[model samples]
Target: MDRYCRRAGALALAVTAATATGALAQDYVIGVAVANSGGLAPFSQPAYDGFKFCVDEMNASGGIAGKHPIRLEVRDTRSEISEAVKFAQEFVDIGVNFIVAPPDGDPTMAMGQITSPAQIPTMTFAGTAPILTSVGEYVFGSYPADNQQAAVLGAYAAELGYKTAFLLKSPDAAYTQFGPAYFGTVFEANGGQVVGEASFTMNQPDFSAIVTTIQALNPPPDVIMTSAWEPDFPAFIKALRGAGVTIPVMGADVLDTPTVRGLGEVVEGVVHTSGGYPDPGSAHAEFNARFEAATGKVADTNYVVNGCDILGMIDAAVQAAGTTDAAAVGQALAALPETEGIMSSYTFAGTDRMPMRSVVLARIEGGEKVIIRREMADPATMPAP
Candidate 1:
């Protein structure tokens, strides 16, 4: 045969082999790498549980087109970038069709580096950075990037007449770093002044020094804006209140974490920005009820909602593509229009691969998280990366 004819025949043979392999599979395995242990574990756990709940529900509803059972193979990334990268390699080696990675920007970026080039479709938990999608066409995130969420918060602060803010930044992670920067820019643009800015790594147990820095200001800030999570989040709040800093506290999406909600009354009156809410609409409310009934637990965090929605989206894309091929699934997801889920409507937004779903603003009031407002995130306001 001539060279062109040989090449075409080879390509056809490869496609036939791939199709047969996918069709013959008794189970389609989805690989999950989450921060099951580490600083991010508390938040990641709920996301993983929510993903599990979605997959289980789909299974109960007759198992993915009534034939091929979808199963998840989970691995704990321990909230470490190295672990996430390492496990991404393993997922590729094991030939899983899709990978669900931790949402935190750093780990998600690392997973994208590994999975994207390997032609694996991936979705992340945190969706903290817009650059996550820049990794490749296969990487997807449901949450608006940090800048979009921050823009909403900045506008809200302006609305609330916040004149000055003390900024507390988690300097080590992308989630914390980029969020506060966009927030600062938008806040300042809105005629609010950032009185002072302090930075800390998440692992630092003590917030006394940072508290002192904020308190040193002559008049002090009228509001404090921060992007901190877990142990750091509560500690920062405790220290600020302890130092007699009574200014209203405002924070980014990190505050929506389950651990932060557990702070209860102490975090009362604290304003937080979030990518999704527990019950954003009727569908989300139904999801929360079904999740509770299935697991015997309350859906306390937004991650739970996002997790279910992401998995559901993947299921939809797979059905549309008619095969577990990674490239086909990615294309289907990108082309899918404003599909509604428990969290919010998601559209892959062409090659951008970023969703412009709604953002939730909530405050801790009377020892419970009360939804203050919900607005569709405008990506146009986001700063260039």
Candidate 2:
């Protein structure tokens, strides 16, 4: 009986040791809440692919600090504001250490409340300036601010000698409203006149009414600027051409997509402002390559770049913190300098959680969105008035 008791005790101890070893090798889960499986799914999928590629590479490389393997817990927010809030709550409940969001200002704004309280550092890929800086130190944005794009668009329009410009946008989307509104304001402030301003609904397939309004503006504006989505651009351009309005059409970063390239001649003269260039040889070349391989498509837009940079930023923060602790990660992210990323080098400026002031202007030339100018907001080139 004494010998049997000793063997049983030894077996129990070995089981506990094996269980503890398995627990020690478990990975740290990072939650990604984007507009996957929704209207923006096409764009978000590429972003998610970029993020996954990053996480896969990290895990293959022995992960952060060589202690924990990284795992992603992705949630599809459906591009709805309420769904985003629910996903954020779910992420909090799951005790996820990191969160990534899509390029929707409203959704990110809703998520800020949950993440801020949980003290989890978030990286948003949206261009919404208000929501981005509003989240305080808890959130950082990989995409350039909406207002920065406005400044770049204004400068590009002025350079093209567009003395009279007409602004058209979708009233429902923050991107549609804020982008054109701010661009118009900056353009007008820079000695250009906004001759006509118009709004449309996102679901509106026909832009005949808006095009008619634009065309009826006595001496038609030299340029017609819009903040429409990629899918809507081709149709809107066709409507404009059908309405016999042949002025140069310009837009925001929404025009920088593979779908836009399919528009061919319709998008030829259009110029748009973006933070990233589509060329694979650009800053995020390897990232783009990985994303393309995973998705069976090229990373030819800002969404993928945003995802790559967000993950890259998180990787840097984890390395800096030396652990996956949320608060420590936030502090490490805040302390990050201008590190070169797959998109651009982001430097935290003062108390602002937004990226450093760098913007690039891209124009559709010969059926491709080509980089025209790269500008950094410095003492000489201050943030737009």
Model 1 C-alpha lDDT per residue in residues 89-207, reported as the tens digit of each score: 99999999788988777788788888898888888875677777887878888777777787889889998998987788877887777777888888887899988889898778799
lDDT of 2 by residue, 74-137 (tens): 8788888788888888988988888887677667767877887799887776545544548656
> What is the lDDT for 225 in model 1?
85
Clashes of 2: 0
Candidate 2 residue spans exceeding 4 A from truth: 1-26, 278-283, 293-295, 378-385
Q: What's the TM-score of every candidate structure?
A: 0.88, 0.88
Residue 216, model 2, lDDT: 83
- Model 1 local distance difference test score: 0.80
Clashing pairs in 1: 103-125, 103-126
